[model samples]
Target: MARTPFDAGAEFDRQVRVLTDLGYPELSGLGPERFGALVAPLRARAMAAQESRYEPGAGAGDEGRVPFLLVVSRNVAPIEETMPRTVLHGGRLPGFVDRTFEPGSLERFVATEETLLPDPDAYLLFDIERGEEFCGVVPRDAMKAIAGRDRTLLTIEEGIALVTHFPQVLVKNKCFSLGGSRCGDRRVPAIWISQKAPKLGWCWEGNPHTWLGMASAGTRTGGVA
Candidate 1:
């Protein structure tokens, strides 16, 4: 399949905005020169990490649910596709899933048996501690159920809704709270969705860059956080 080229500059700006929105004030102080010098390379690496040949719903037809595991422990049996987990840190505001996830650079999940799992188009993200409570979500009709919803189906708000559907999980993104007060890591929310949901796939609109910078902590050059 033909692919779209990665846009580093645009991604850099998007990440910069993501950082600023996450309450890192230092990014606002950096000139373009400094940011390009330090942060751009990191962004490039992130872009590289997310590179994959997978296309959304490529092989996914209206079929059985994609097996998903809500793994909270760093040490867990490897699943087929390693869902990228993101931390909603102690002092951050969560508006959308993209905003919350844009900072969690990629993690190291090794798959011991690649033959046993589905060639998943995307991975679901969950924090180590917060995700422990979840067993997994098996959609009644994985593809049909998700495809019916609006585009907002993949946002953090909706993602939380899906998680809270399971018993014993109560969560609210800070953006919806009264004062937007900081919540400790324990209170941080985790998003668990069916592995079959095409909306959550790592490949976005024919480009695999969606998850590239998903985990970077921003550039470290010149003390410009």
Candidate 2:
């Protein structure tokens, strides 16, 4: 895929509008001004940053990936609520939660040791990949591989935010897992295509599906508002 030239400020503003339409301001309790400040650092980076070109031997996870993923922290935009809003196919396709994700299931899943939330309501993830390389790898092994490579896996909130903002990334047969958030059990959360709509479900940690890859990021950053 080609990286089209884009104006970062404009793109950032567009996403902000989309998020605002999603009613994130009320959810974050930041009204509008504080929410803007919460994500200012990300806008600053986006304005000055250029697209990522894979470094030599950087690995398959480096290419065709977004340079930064804007995340509304789970503290404010809870996954249970955000999951249903992960619209795809230009908002024509709706998102769903698997029935298996019963009450209290999401509460058990928190950020892993490596997944840090720098802000109370928002943050940015750099060098995020849908992890096309880790397809067919079980969640257990993929976690080790991500840690070994000095990368961090995407949390459930991050996964939801990614597709919420960049729906084009969640295509059929190429869906990714959220190994960074766990319930201290074998289940790993993921977003995949179901009935032509995106759905949030869980796959066993030891199970490997040819269609499921792990999502990851280079690092995370955010600020206090």
The number of the candidate with the highest TM-score is 2
For each candidate in turn, the TM-score is 0.24, 0.86
- Candidate 1 lDDT, 58-112, residue by residue in tens: 2210121111111111222111111222223231222223233233321321222
Q: In candidate 1, where is summed lDDT lowest over 10 consecutive residues?
A: 173-182
- For 1-225, candidate 2 gives per-residue lDDT tens digits of 654455556666777887888888877788888877777777876555444433322322234377666788778777767777777755576688889988878788888777876665677777788987888998889989999999999988888878887888888778999998888888999999997778989999999999999999897776432
Model 1, residue pairs in steric clash: 104-215, 105-214, 105-215, 105-216
Query: Cα lDDT for residue 152, model 1?
Result: 10
Candidate 1 residue runs with Cα over 4 Å from true position: 1-12, 20-32, 53-170, 173-225
Candidate 1: give its CA RMSD in angstroms: 17.1
lDDT of 1 at 96: 27
